[model samples]
Target: MKVGVVTFPGSLDDVDAQRAVRLGGHEAVALWHGDHNLQGVDAVVLPGGFSYGDYLRCGAISRFSPVMTEVVEAAGRGMPVLGICNGFQILCESHLLPGALVRNQRQKFLCLDQRLRIERTDTPWTAAYAEGQEVVIALKNGEGSFVADTETLDRLEGEGQVVARYLGENPNGSLRDIAGVSNERGNVVGLMPHPEHSVEELCGTGTDGLGFFALATLAAEVFA
Candidate 1:
């Protein structure tokens, strides 16, 4: 599988995301945000980081990058698009996924290995996980709170669009403890946690995050 990882002006985790893709037995394609090309990648991963130095509300500015035009189109065509952390924010900002990411309730940047429950494994990025499975992944961000209106929240829950939820405690006060969500098509997913950071067991967070990449490969194989 060829997974494209987008790099923006201030992206901080592109390297790690690329490494994770390679570690998952796939080629990692480096994509520039300014480029209007996808390089024919099978799947795409929007890695976490402070794009545009988080100058205009995390991923607000980066959502308008030229590459996003192609991304939005591809994703709409049912191609898998996994957005992590800041990428999640961009997905929301782009309206590919619903809701907005606001500042953490504590008003501080947090970095830790977070426990998450796999609420829905039907998406492109979570097929390897069993429903209700608990996995730990590293999460780091200042503006990571996920917010939406009551009706939207109800719809997400009612439709089973909520992909993952925080276990034990909510980290950023995300509404309903939502750690991840997927679009109605299931091809586009946005998650607040950094699964790429936990792909290596040596990193101490364990390799549970590898399930996400492995799941992507499985989904591609199943569909192709």
Candidate 2:
């Protein structure tokens, strides 16, 4: 399996994400935000950080990155794409996922190892977990609150698009405590937590997040 991790300016987690992919037994390809090619990777990961220094808005500038055009097109064709943190914001900005991530309701950056419940394991990025499984991963960001119109929220819940929900407490006041979501096709997913950071147990967060990368590789195998 070959996984591409995009690095945008200020992207702090791209290297970590690539390491996670490599640890998951996949080839980790470094991708540039300015590149138009995906380098024939099997899947893509949008790592976290304050891209473009979070100017204008989190992920606003990154949504227009040259790579995003390919990402959007590939995702439309069922290529699995996982967007983490600021990447999640980009997914929403690109309309790859529903809802917008706003400033934390508390108006502060949050950093913690948060517990999350797997709500939709059928997506390509989450198939390694059973529904209702509990896993803890690192979460950190300044703008991580998820918001959408009432109808959109209801639709997401109704359509089973809610991929993961905060387990202990809502850290950012995300609606329904949503920590992650998948597109209707289930190929594209965006999550607020930093799964790439938790894939190494020596780092102390456990290997729970390893499943995310593993599952994407597995899905590629299954569909190949």
Candidate 3:
């Protein structure tokens, strides 16, 4: 399996994301934000970062990158796309997933090994996880709060599109404790946690985050 990780002007986690893909037994392809092609990768990852110096707004400017044009088109065709942290913000800004990411309720940057419950495992990126399993992954962001209207929140909960939820306590005050969410088709997912950062065993943290990149083993069927 091949996973493409896009690098934007100010992307800081592209390297970690690529390493996670390689650690997951998949070919890691470096993709540029300005590129016009997707390099025929099986899946794509929008790594977390302060793209464009977090100008205008987090992920607001990066969403208009040339590569996003292809990404949006590919997602429309049901390709698996995973967005982490700032990438999640971009996904929301692009309207690929419903709702919006606002500043944390506490109005401060937070970094922690967050506990998340797997709400749904049918998505390609989460097939390795069991439903209701609690896994810890690195969570870091400022504008990580997930917000949506009452009706939209009900729809997400009713339809089971809420992919993951914070366990114990909400880190950034995300509405309904939503740590992650998927589109109606489940091919596109966006999460406020940084799963790529915890994939290395030598890093001291457990390798529980490897599930995000494990999609290579099952993504073929999902993409097909």
Clashes of each: 0, 0, 0
Model 3 residue runs over 4 Å out of place are: 216-224
Q: Would you list the clashing residue pairs of candidate 1?
A: none
Comparison by lDDT, 2 against 3, better one: 2
Per-residue C-alpha lDDT of model 3 across residues 98-192, encoded as one tens digit per residue: 99999999999999989999898989989889999899898999999999999999999999999999998788999999999999989899999
Ten residues in a row with the worst lDDT in model 2?
A: 214-223
- Candidate 3, residue 109: how far the Cα is off, in Å: 0.4
Q: Residue 54 deviation, candidate 3, in Å?
A: 1.4
Residue 58 CA displacement from its true place in model 2, Å: 0.6
- Candidate 1: regions farther than 4 A off: 216-223
lDDT of the structure predicted as candidate 3: 0.91
Q: Model 2 over residues 115-207: C-alpha lDDT tens digits?
A: 999999988789989999999999998899999999999999999999999988799999989999999988899999999999986894898
